[model samples]
Target: MAYEVLVQSVVDYAIYLLDREGRVSSWNPGAERIKGYSPGEILGKHFSRFYTEEDRHADVPEAALGPSLGGDIQFETAVP
Candidate 1:
């Protein structure tokens, strides 16, 4: 589909889809390039792995599930 093509072509921004439970449902090329996880390794995994320990302890991931208006949530990560 056109959307898949666009997501695959973009390399600057990581574009992915997470299920309602925060599980990674779709992994795009940009996501693999930026996050360093191939789809095989990351697909169906909980996205909280990207959050810092403090963030996880503070329930930041839970808070990030805000209104489903399709917006972005900026967070600090421990991954280098």
Candidate 2:
């Protein structure tokens, strides 16, 4: 099986790659569909853009990055 091709073509799951400092380094088509952002628009941006204002104020983005950076973490959330 061609795993890379299968993952890249997924439309039902958003895939993101964040840098050490938590900026978006990669974006996928499914992420575009779910988050309303194109790869060009979101890449190089902070992943915090996906969170609510109150969450940002609470440092939720930084907190969330810890687990993902330490190891693979799968999560799902709906963004308005």
- The residue-by-residue lDDT of candidate 2 on 1-80, one tens digit each, is 58667767988889878999999987777989988899889999999989988778877778778786785444454455
* lDDT, residue 38, model 2: 94
Query: Model 1 TM-score?
Result: 0.79
Model 1 CA deviation exceeding 4 Å by range: 69-80
lDDT of each: 0.83, 0.82
In candidate 1, the residue pairs with backbone N, CA or C atoms under 3 Å apart (3 or more residues apart, or in different chains) clash, namely none
User: Please, what are the lDDT tens digits per residue for candidate 1 over residues 1-80?
Assistant: 99989888888889999998888999888899999899999999988788878888987776677544466676544553
Model 1 lDDT-worst window of ten: 71-80
At residue 57, what lDDT does model 2 achieve?
82
Q: How many residue pairs clash in each candidate?
A: 0, 0
